[model samples]
Structure formats: structure tokens, C-alpha cells
Target: MVDQDIFDRLLQFRPSGAPVLSVYVGVDGGPSALRTKLESLVGEVLEQAEAEPSQALRRSLLSDVARVLDLAARGGPPEGSTVGIFACHRAGLYEEVVVPRRARDRAVVDATPYLRPLLAFLDESRRYCLVVLDRMQACLYELFMGELEGATIVVTPGKPGRPVGRDPSPAHRLFRETADVADEFIHATRAELLLVGGPEETVAAFLPFVPHHLRGRVAGTFAFDPRTMGPEQARCCAEAVVDRYERAEEASLVAEILDRVTTGGLGAAGIPWCLAAVNEEAVQFLLIDEEARASGSACDACGWLGLVGATCQRCGGPLRVTQDVIEEMGAAVIGASGRVEHVQAPTPLSQHSVAAFLRFDVPHSAAQVVG
Candidate 1:
């Protein structure tokens, strides 16, 4: 699992020691394909390394590449479909992270690891906590982007001889105690959604013990015998519920954004409004159509993005054309700690292709309609 410690070290790393070799490789099917991909990645790195004026540094970079290749050769069960390998033999830093999502394949020899792309890919998926529970036992696991992490078995808090004064039965006591553990896990992980899987009766009884605040986060529940259920089966069942929940949530978000836009509220619709709001750092929530695409120009010098502009209105720098300005807008919103929702089709969100709810009303506008 890619945890906070890894991020802390990577971000703080300086180039005083040796150049870090950061490799993002996709796992196709078998070992042969991985080998070919690694070879190509190393080849590309070597080609770039040739220009290095220092021979020792160049050789060290190659050694880093070989270290990654060796890791690939002595592979175990892959954690994610794609793997990010960072190695610097001289710096005594070598970490292999398997990622659930796929990102572009790239190899870089730099003082610091190229991490933005990896973090972006991870951001595409929301975090969820899955509890495979029964009256006797509860297994809590963290699920990121549908990938399951190891479970932490949480049994009832008390031991066999512990006092059970008011509890009617041991089974009832287990349900309440397990629910507390689940709540702690969810809060600690900041899980966006919660899923419970167990026999129907047990799930029904267990949910009542969940605090009202946490109960609101329950996405769905499914039937399973925790003793007999496997990880693959559990994922399949939970994913179906997640799919339904997300679809409904997206549609509702689009409806609210559109309603606000029409009523002269906080909302603003269409690409032009979105571009302006993002530039002003006023987007509290950005709603965009998943299939929408647009060609636009951006002022790289000032981090300004807009449609139909040859020169930056804010700065005199020449605007560069971007294939899809919607992506640029999304990235900007995420960077600002705002929410970005990609609304699905069969919704009114497609009319604007882009929209936003501003943090505060702009001087000249309460709500904007681009058409």
C-alpha cells in the first residue's frame, strides 16, 4: 500500500546524492510483456542518460535501472495492475508500489521522483471501507479504487471472561462492539463510503449500533457468510452497489448544479463561466460532463486557462493551445482543494459541458449562463 510515509520521503528527497530512477510500468498479462516493457523503459532512460557529462552519475543511473529490472524479475503477487518503481542505489532508497489504476508509461532520471502523474491517477478513484462482518467476527478492510487491502480482523472488544452485565446475549454484544470498531476504522481512514457484508439478519441488527453520523455514510450492504466469502466474491458484490450509488449521486449533483444556475444562485454553467471561476479560485464545486472535450488555449506563464483566446487576458504571454481544456480545469480545481464531479450522460450537464459553483459571488454575477 502507498502510505503517508512513502509520500513524505519522496517529497523531501533532494538530489545531492544520486539521481532517482522513477519508472511507471503497466502490467499487461505475463512476465514476457513486463520484461519487454522494462527493457524499453531502461533503453529510453539510457538514451537520455548518454548526454550526462558526469560518467559516475550516468553509471549510477544505469545501476538504478538494473535494480528496478531485478525487482521485476523476482516478482511476487502484484498489488495493482500498474507498478511504480523508484530506485537509487547510492541513496539507499528502493521502493516498489503497485497501483490499482493505469497511468502513462514513463521513465525519468531526476533528483526527485515524478509523482504528480501517479497521484493524479490515484485521485480518480474514491476511498471506501469494506467490512465483511458476522455476529461472531468482523473483518475490516480498506478498498481504494475497488482494490482491497489486507483485512484487520476485529473481534468483540471483551475477552471470554470479561463482564457482559447488561447484554442479553454474547452475539448481540459482538454486533455492537464490532460496529464501534468499524466506525473507528472509517473515521481513521476518512473513508468516503462504507459497505457492510454479512448474513442479512446480522447486517440488519448491526447497522442499528452504528452512530447516526456514520450511518449516513453507508453506501450499501450485501449478503454474505463471512466465514465462506472470498475476496473476489466480496468485491464483485460490493462494486455493484457502489456503481448504483455513484450513478444516482452524479445525476443528483447535476440536477442541483443546473437548478442553481437557473435560479441565479451560486452556480454558473458552460465552459466560459467555468474557466473564469477557476481562474479566480472561486470554484467550490466543479461539475463537468465525462464525455465533454474542447480545444482551448492556456497561459502557461500565469496558470490561466480559457476558451477562444490568443493572448492571455490576465497576462501578455502568448497562450498555448491545449487539446482538452476541460482536463486542465479539473486539475486546477483539484489543486485548489475543491470538489470536481464528472457527471455522466443522460443528464442536463451535457448542455454546458462544464459548470461550477463559486465560493463567493463574482462582482458582476450571481449566476452565469453562457448561452
Candidate 2:
């Protein structure tokens, strides 16, 4: 898991005179295979850097890359599909991060670090917490992007006998105790969504005891016998709940955007309109279909993005054609500190593939309907 504080610290690092080496290498499969592959990759990166203009800077950069190699050789890769290494001797910045998602091998030497991929992956993975509880035993599971971190049994004391009017029942008191334990774990994990599963009656009893804030964030409940359930079964149930919740949220966002487009309010649909909104820094939230693609052009000089053009209309500069303009638009939105949502398949945004809620309205004329 990438530590939020550490990530923020890395982002705060200032650029120095020398170039920073940002390397991301895949480390999936066997550890031995990864180790062998990583050595060759590191050698290739260093060999290329040696031919750079600045001899003195290249030597210093090589030393830093050597340090990264040493660290990897000693510790091997952390438990993840990919690892990110950022090193700069001049800036005195050196860090390695294990990312859950897969990343292609990339080596870049730039004044500032290349962090777009990591940031995008983090944005895509919203953390969730799963609590499986029954009468005798309870467990809490922390999930990141549908992958289970670990699970542990929760311990709580049994409640006293039931009371009459205005007094809590024994079952209520017991559930409240379980909720307290679960609450502490949830806070520590910083889970965005909470899902509860167990025998039906226990889940019913526990739901009312959950704190109001957490209760609001509950995705949904499912049925699972904690005593009989294994890790795989628990993971499947939690993932299903999250999938359903995310799908519903996506549907709601698409519906809201459609309504806003019709009313000429805070939303815009289609690639051109969303691109315009992104350029204007007007997007509050960007909605894009998961498998949607829009091949378009962007101006390097003026940073103008459009669906079509041989040359930039705003600037006379030449245009650079891209495979997917939506990706560029997403990067722009993230650069402006706006949120992004990649809606799953079978969404209402299927036709347009791109949509956004703006910080302020752009007139309907700005949007162009594209096939």
C-alpha cells in the first residue's frame, strides 16, 4: 500500500539542477524472474543516461540509479504488481513505492518526477472496508480496489440481559459493542465505503448500531456465514457489493449529467465540450466511459485540445494527433485539481464517451455533437 503521507512528501520535493530519474518496472510473477529482469532494465536505463550531454550530471545520476539497483537487489520488489523508484542526487530525493495495479516499464529523466500514472491508479482505486459478523465471532476485512489486504477476528464482550421500555435489548447492546470495534478499525483503515455481511439477523441488528456517519457510507449488505466462509468467499462477496455500489453511483452520475445538459446547467456531454471545459479549468468532476476512445489532436504550443484539426485553430502551431483524447482530457482535469470518474460498461455515456460537471456553465453552443 502507498502511504498517503509519503506520497505527499514526494510530491513536495523541489527540482534541483540535475535531472531526476523516475523509473517504473513491472515485478509480477516469480520473485526470481523479476529480480533478473529488473537488473537488465536498470542497466539499459543507465547505459542510455551515460550518453547525455552533461558528463558530471550523468555520473551523479548513475550513482543514484546504482543506489536504486542496490536497494532492489537487497530487498527485492515489495508485494505488488509494479514498483516505482524516484531518485535524484541533486534534489536529495530517493523513494520506492509498491503499487497494486500493473504498470508498464518506463524510465524517464526529467526536471520533475513523472507521477501521472501513480496518481491515476490511486484515483481509480477507492478503498473499502468489509465487516463480517455473526453471533459468536466477527471479522473485519480491508479491501483496496477489490483486493483484500487481510482479515482479523474482532473481539467484543457479550451484553447484559434485555431491558423493557427505553432500555436497550441484550442483542442491541451486543451489536453496539461490535459496531464500536468495527468503527475503530474503519477509522484506522480510512475506508471510503463500508459493507457488512453475516447471518441475516445479526447484520440487521448491527446496522442500527453503526454510527450515523458510517451508516451513510454503507454500500450494501450481503449474506455470509462467517464461521463457514473462507477468504475467497469473503472476498467475492465484498467485491460484488462494491461492484453494485459503484455501478449505481456511475448510473446516478450519468443521469445527473444528462439532465444538466438538457437544462443548460452545470454539465456538458461529448468530447469537444468536455475538452473545452477541461481547458477552461471549469470541470468539477469528469465522467468518462471505461472503454471509450476519441482519436483527436492537441496543440503543443497553446495547449489547445480538440476532436479534429490538422493545425491548431486557436494557435497556428502544428497539431499532435493522439490515440485517445479522453486520456489527455483526464490528465488536464487532474492537473486542475478536479475529480474524475471512469464509468463502467453499459453506461448512458456510451454514445459520447466523455462528460463532465463544470464549476461554471459554458453555453450549449460550445458543445459539438460528434459520432
lDDT per residue (tens digit) for residues 18-71 in model 2:
777878877766656666666777776677677878887887788777876665
The sequence of per-residue lDDT tens digits that candidate 1 reaches over residues 146-196 is 678768786764356656887867677777777777788888988888998
**Clashing pairs for predicted structure model 1, backbone only:** none
In model 2, the runs with Cα more than 4 Å from the true position are 2-98, 101-120, 145-153, 156-171, 184-189, 230-233, 310-316, 367-371
Q: What's the CA error at residue 271 for candidate 2, in Å?
A: 0.6
For candidate 2, report its TM-score. 0.68
lDDT of 1 at 346: 62
- Candidate 2, lDDT over the whole model: 0.75
The runs of at least 3 residues in candidate 1 whose Cα sits more than 4 Å from the true structure, single-residue gaps closed, are 1-26, 34-80, 83-98, 102-125, 155-166, 344-346, 363-371
Candidate 2 steric clashes: 0
Report lDDT (Cα) of residue 129, candidate 1: 88
Please, what is the TM-score per model?
A: 0.69, 0.68
lDDT (C-alpha) at residue 9 in model 1: 72
